[model samples]
Target chain A: MRRHTFTRFAEALPAAVLAACSGPQSPLDAGSDEAAGIAILSWVMFAAAGLILVAVLALAAAAARAPAEQPRWATREGWVVAAGLVFPIVMLSALLAWGLSITGGGGGASSPPAAFRIAVAGEQWWWRVTYLGPDGSALFSTANELRLPIGQRVEVDLTSADVIHSFWVPGLAGKLDMIPGHVNTLPLVAGRAGTWRGQCAEYCGGAHALMAFTVTALPAPDFERWMAAQAAPAAEPDNAEGRRGRALFLASGCGACHAVRGTPASGTIGPDLTHVGGRPTIGAGLLPTQRGTLAAWIVDPGHLKPEVRMPPFPVFRGEDLRALAAWLESLR
Target chain B: MRRTLVILGLLVALGAVGALLFAWSGLYNVAASVPHWPPTRWLIEFGLENSVETHARGIEVPPLDDPALVHAGLGHYEGACQPCHGAPGQPPNPLVRRMLPEPPYLPGQELRWSPAQLFWIVRHGLKYTGMPAWVAEHRDDEIWAMVAALLRLPELDDAGYRRLLASGARMPAGESARLLAAVGPAGEALVACARCHGLTGAGGGAGAFPALAGQSREYLMASLKAYALGTRASGFMQPVAGALDDEQMGRLADHYAAMPTPPVRPAPNAATERGRAIAERGLPERGIPACVTCHGGNALARNRLFPRLDGQHAFYLAQQLRLFAVGTRGGTAFAELMQATTHGLDEAEIRAVAAYYAARGRPR
Candidate 1:
């Protein structure tokens, strides 16, 4: 009984490890149709490979156990005809056909046209996401996070600002390279409403390891609401402290690199802060969106994410720091 | 075996004699104009790399993520290190470039060393290299600050570096206007004060210098006198303070004391609360009086000799408190009281109370 229990535990160990491997970010979890198809194909290939391994092992065992004399049926010529040439030809042909069918182009002919489109520009260490309206004009701009409507085909136009970066959201679709001066298109449809993590797979520069974002798939109406809110300018400060914060924000030279709509801070060098308060994370997902974190990030972004372009603001102290944080948090 | 041993011993003795003779001969070139041979250069560099790596292996780095550290490091770098090592936009002096084994440009050099390695190099500079050890060895915190700034050097361009260096000396508009107007005839003399102690008395050197804002007028005057009379032994302050006459000293003291106190943000630590507790309610068990009884917390009238601690830098405050605990920092009449009060407090208690006072603000 003890031996049986031990054997059962040993069998379950691999399953436990496999379970731990498939997190919200794992491609094998397959939250979308494209990812599911890829996962299914991967499983099929793994099983076929396992079968091939078992057959080869059995043949090797048989050969090892054979007596001094070889059987007539197991001649060298016969082994070459069956194992060396014919078996490989048949197995390879089947795998090629199966792969072509699964990943064949124009497979989405029966699906409806894409509901919306997003253009993602990859920079040194951050993502610049822009939602495109029907007329090809930008509807809204956000950074480090992408939002999508569930069960809707969305076309993502990928490009680069500085160097080549790959946008890979494993739970949704395959990786696509964002090449400089050229736009690559990727169509994705998430079947469920959930939050998935995406990462820049390319080795960009100093902060490449920290270049990650989140993709939140919501119901159509909820996505619409989020888009509408993101389109508007940041709300005005409602209190004296917030007003002081706004003044400090402009006077402290923060306007040189960042943009805030309806304000004089129109520099396009850094991320847009129009609706920054609504985002769940800041500093390229390095920290959670909270008052203390926001203040800390403003004080020293390079410390949190080393080699970031933003300089530390040691001049801000006491009520000034608090006010700045309050004004940013009130943007939503 | 006996023959082989004898041969080996003779060889060792001959080698030592040859080395001593070579040293005495003075035939080896030691001119700065002459570069080391490739092998010799490689040996020195190899030794330096291994030494730094081994020494840095066990160094536990403190939290260098603070922006304050970076800002202070930039100021120190511009003042001292920039002459030898070039900044992002500014090049090193031409004379320094001609030095043997020229100092490498530091903009992208931080990528090669880990934080601990950088700390070790800064703390204990390499031999035969012009890199000198930190002047103040006890200030490891300042070394870490420079390391933090070095790590961020790659991200900044010329304009960005200039901006960062400029940010350290900036004063509020109102304070600047007021100070500029007050410099009637002693223009250069008055302006010199703003160089280290900012126009608003906020202190440009971070914790390297003390903030003069919100200090009691009497304390300022008395301290200046102590510096002038050679009672205070600061090499940096003594010369400047000694140069001033009675009228100039009094006017400067009154001017800084009257200025609005700059705000000092409290560090996010458990010590802040513990500090506030001790500052408000005295640790009676330890025979310490509540700090507010004399320092003036709410609206209480304070003694002029007792310096105002509100809005002072936590680092400066902690340093002073420690000095008082050790009975070294002397002041006006009530200095003994501070020494006695601090004698019963531990390091943590002193730090907490200092932080509490540093974060406190004077009533309008």
Candidate 2:
């Protein structure tokens, strides 16, 4: 029975591994033009590697089957010239040129002009994404999430607020470093409208492993609508509980580090919360955005994301905490 | 050779048994009157001094020359230390001299030990002796203040001592009669508190004390209970509050809470603009909350447990904030929030915020 189970597991393992290569976060999934080019380059390299493996295996097989003496064609000198010396140089040089053509065409500082630019500042363990207008003025800012218009090349001006962090969206483009005091640009052109997961590729301080974001590529009209909505002030809470929560939030020190535009709570230390209710995740994608998750986050942010700068509000309890979280969720 | 070795081992075992029996017999002198032999006394003294020196090695002493700090230390010394360790000219009571390990007179102590060593000894008192560890274990600031006074003792004559203590108000005579005449029935049990806080709770002795008048009843009660439980680190208030029963604590809280607030001190110079900014808006970039959100007079914050900061002494507020930064200022359960909030503030910001609050009068 155990042998049968092992046989089944071995058969399924290859399929599972292949499946893993095509997910929301997989480079091979290739949601953007840049990523598709990378995918083709990757496949070509893999094919070359497979051909080399087959040739080496065939030579070994022939050597094992042949008599003690080998033929002149299979001698050390002949193999060295064909496989060892000539093969690597030719294969590597080809792969390098191909890889460069794919990455360099749309990558680096001197790439073609983008339709619009966005500024992404890497904080300790979070991303502060600011959407810029055509004139380079900031339209609105959000945290840990990016919204892009599909089929249009959007340039991302990346820099670090504190330390070095690498911005990586595997399905969109290659990773780029966000170095402190230096701006590095990454051009992204989404070929399809979908959500792709991104993560901090570099090891920042504590909570870096939890620092993740999502890029939503939308149709131009939808993207425009999202920007307009995000730029507007937070809506007034309609319910009594939400109104109470707003009062409690200002009364408690939530306004000190987080800002909700067009309110007395205009703090710039932490993320903007004008459209927090529309977000799919909070705490920089540490938890799914919901009332329960939001409440847990507010009461104990460090518990959810270690070394978080936001202090815990253990004083909020039961109905008060619930009301506060609901009000925040209603901010959209 | 084997027989001889066996005999030697037996002899060693026998000696061990004999020593055990001797200890069990209880024939040795154990009375306080019967002083230790010279060797035993030397060994204990050696161990005590060495232990203090070892533990006190890394303690960094702050500047102790401030006149206000020395003055405040003198205030605590008069009530807490003088009774046991005796001042320069005043000898301890005749009965106190009879204790097993007698407390030493504190004058000229700097000649014998460094300020750090004295701090360690005072903070963690002699274990076997009658000397008790400080009531508030987390309050190193208060203990350091005491050390500053101890360092000054060798030079202070009795006249100087009296002069330094002149600012500390004396308790009124006839407890009930005076208490009734002062702040009414609530003041009846506040004789010890009034020594520094004054009868009406208008804090006295420059900025050394914090004014308690016009504070909320809930805050006052919580503070008193915290001190009694030793959660709040104040060596001065711990023992006083610990001695009071629940009812007495309630009355004391009520007494101070109902007392009318004193007139606001004149605002400091325009240099406090930085402080005003911090108090109103906070250093948001550093993740520090605005002091006005909860403690401001204009905030009208609903959390009654958070004490009113307006008109409080700037020096006292600044010192408390410094203590909070180091996680040494233990207070009510909500105080942890202050610890988190103040963690990012620099020294200049702390001073500025304190000054802003101290000059602002009366919580609305």
Candidate 3:
């Protein structure tokens, strides 16, 4: 009985790990049509590869078991032509066709002409996502996080500020390189409402591993509401602590790099933090957005993500840090 | 053996020619705009890691738990290191971020190095990287202080760090103009005094600096003159005093003397008792005189030049006593008297007396 239990646990271990991988961010958990198509292609390739491996192994084993003196079914030349040339050509052609069909079937043609469009700029270790209004002007700006409406095709215009960086949302769309001085367009449609993960596929610098973002696909109405809220300036802090924090933020030279929309923090050096409080993560997805984590990040961003642009504030202490954190959180 | 040798020689010749050809080809991209190939990058990183690890081995780390050391380090870091390394709640300069090998933010990076390795890297700096060596080579103590601060950096929040920076002597606002006016010919030079002595003359914490508040105007003036005339030797204070004339010196002395003194709050413990005993009673066997004879509040009226010791930082008092015993701190003629009085007292006795005086009643 003990052995049986141990065996069961051992067998279940891999399945358990695989199950854990099916998180909101997992590529295997396809929440969008694009991701599902990729998944299907992946399974097909896996099955084909498995069959090829089994066939090759079986042939080798059968050949070894057969007597050397036994007559061959066909000459060595015939076998080589059949297995290496003909088999590969047929299988590869089929796989290529499938891949082309999946990729060539662009989501834009099927979607409405008035699709939501966003421009995502890849920085050294972060994403600068801007939503565009009808007139092609930026409606609002956010960093490290992208929000899309479910069942709506969205076009993302990708570009890079410095070195080359590839934007990849494995759960939503294929990887696309964001090259400096060039813009690449990627259209994605989320068939379901869920959160997915996006990461910088290219190695940009010291913090490339830490460069990640969340893609939350909400219902059409909810996404519109979120966009509207993001477009507005940050609300006035409600409490005395928050007010003090806002003052600290301004006084401490935070406004010189980050923007809070309504505030005088109109600097363009860092991310737009107008609706930062509502975001699920901060520091380019290096940390979850919580009061404690936000405070810690403000205190020392380099600690959380090495080589980050944000400097630590060794000058703020106690009530000031708390107040600043509260005020930032209240931005939502 | 002959055949092997010939083949080896030919291979070496061919390898050299190949290398020469490659060097002259100009096919290798040397652009800073692009990163090295993965293998090349890995090799360089590997070399750096091993070199740092090897050189950092066996370095004895000093006890870095002292808050005072951390405070001092924070001050130095803010002024010198913060531009590139950055502190909590600030970002590095934008131009600095564009460097090829970007400087890592120290808060998270501090954990990667051992305290001793940090010291080594800080003092010697990494070769080929933008990190610079320490300007003051002999100040290992200051470097250690910085290491101490780095060790605690991961745990410190912005507020905690700011508090550490603010722990030292604070300058009083609205007094610079008055001070400048008081020392007419001195002009802006008087402002430098506040950097160490503070605008209110309260001194840095725990007597790392001496409190100038409530000190006799005559003593202050005499000390400045001694410093100016080379009668007293202090590497830190001599330069400032040497630059001033007698009138300017007198005005600065008066300015500090007139400033309001801070309240005394000494730690009360067994040390305080021993300190009080040493101050009140003479060590008859050791031929040590009671401190009250010269420095007590009761004796202040008799000698106008005697500096008031009450409510002064113990650290400063103990340090002065040690300096007097060593005959390095030469003050006015009365300094000899201090040397003689302090000659017989041991380090512990001196500490006790300093602590006692530090906890004594406010300066009259």
Candidate that would win on TM-score? 2
**Model 2 residue B6 lDDT score:** 100
Model 1 per-residue lDDT tens digits across residues A178-213: 998899999989899999989999898899998889
Model 2 docking category: acceptable
Model 1 / residue A157 / CA error / Å? 0.9
For candidate 3, lDDT tens digit of each residue in A1-332? 64466456555655665674477566767877778878777767755765676567657656767876865764568878988999899988998998898878765376566486899999878899999987789988999998889888788999988889999888887889999889999887888887888899898989899999999999989988998899889999888999898887765546545779998665454788898899999988888888788899987788888877665675568988899998998888
Candidate 2 lDDT over residue span B7-108, tens digit each: 999999999999999989998878888888999989999998899899999999988876667767887888788898777678667776877777777764
Q: Between candidates 1 and 2, which one is better according to lDDT?
A: 2
Q: How close is each model in CA RMSD to the real structure?
A: 20.3, 4.3, 27.7
TM-score of predicted chain B versus true chain B for each candidate: 0.70, 0.86, 0.60
Alpha-carbon lDDT, every model: 0.75, 0.81, 0.76
DockQ of each: 0.00, 0.41, 0.00
Model 2 residue A85 lDDT score: 81
Taking chain A by itself, what TM-score does each prediction score? 0.90, 0.91, 0.91
Q: Lowest lDDT 10-mer window, candidate 2 chain A? A: A2-11
**Pick by DockQ: 2 or 3, better one:** 2
Candidate that scores best on DockQ? 2
lDDT value, residue A243 of candidate 2: 91
Candidate 3 residue spans exceeding 4 A from truth: A1-21, A107-111, B1-364
